[model samples]
Target: MIESKLISKALFSDKSVKSVNNLKDYAGIEYIASMNQTHSDLVTFVKSSAVYDSDGIYTEEPKLGLVVKTADCMPILLSDKKRIGAIHSGWRGLKSNILEKAIKKFDVNELSISIGPHAQSCCYEVKEDVKKYFNDYTELRDGMFFLNMSKVLKDLSEKEGFQVEVSSICTICNSSYNSYRENKTTARQFGVIWK
Candidate 1:
């Protein structure tokens, strides 16, 4: 049994489909869309349920959902008056410039962003070699590297004129969400946004 309950528990009673029903029911939307997700910078502006080999997707169509699953990877939802996006960004995706790719499609003057739970710098330690891809976003402490992905993402989005809101919960620190770094499990927590 899943101890941590979601915002809409009734939609998740049958966990066989993860939380798709929760999103559909909570948002009152019908169509569900997603990507194959390769941890790359690929961002596609989609309109239907057609799956693509990308890490991010956005749409302006009503009653449609843009979904992505994550454990430790950051789930970013980009929104504006006319568009909505869901992104999957880990260190690799960030380094590949996924955020910029997703934001470029929308008008920043009307955009507002929400970053979902993920592994924060407080527990996300990395090797020194991986530090070369990021400079201002990472810190070297006690001969180890820690990444502030939320800040990096916030800074980047703000630079592009989007109002950003980051999640206070960390997947590694909060057992409510799944974390690969904590359990080496492929199980992921779903994050979705729709129009």
Candidate 2:
């Protein structure tokens, strides 16, 4: 488990742990709320511990850890200390503006965003179908296209008047984390945050 010093009360779990339930003892936060991410723009508010059917989950409830499970997709955590959120941002989620919808739940001036291990542009090569949606953040090399999720998300969050700290670890190239694009792994890492 790795903690971000810039974003308090959060941890980005690597392949060492497969589920948020296993992270309870390690993170010291027993109750965690998670969601069945569908890569949509759906953002849900949490006041208790229960699995939701959305890509984003946020809460003002104390000690309720909000967790987002991901393999290669971006695991993002949002917090202002009193309130916190976890977002599962994939290409579909990004195209739907899930991050922006979650940001609206809090005052942007006090929010801090953390992006965990994901498929970076270096290894996130995409075909024209996917690349077209992210033209401004895509790069073409040797006639192939790559999508820079960090740059895309960072720019989007900054434009909303908040700072974003992204982990440089690329899941596709790093063995510490699981990557769906790497090996079609069913395993996932958890990005958890709480007040």
Q: Best candidate, TM-score-wise?
A: 2
lDDT (Cα atoms) of all candidates against the true structure: 0.75, 0.88
Highest lDDT against the true fold, candidate:
2
lDDT of 2 by residue, 47-157 (tens): 888999999999988878888899999999988846788999988888888888999898888989999999999999999999889999899999999999889778877
For model 2, the local distance difference test gives 0.88
Clashes of each: 0, 0
lDDT (Cα, 0-100) at 140 in candidate 1: 82
In the range 16-94, model 1's lDDT, one tens digit per residue, is 3366667667666788887888889998878787677889988889878777778888887777778888899999988
Model 2 CA lDDT for position 2: 80
* C-alpha lDDT (0 to 100) for residue 108 of candidate 1: 78
TM-score of each: 0.87, 0.96
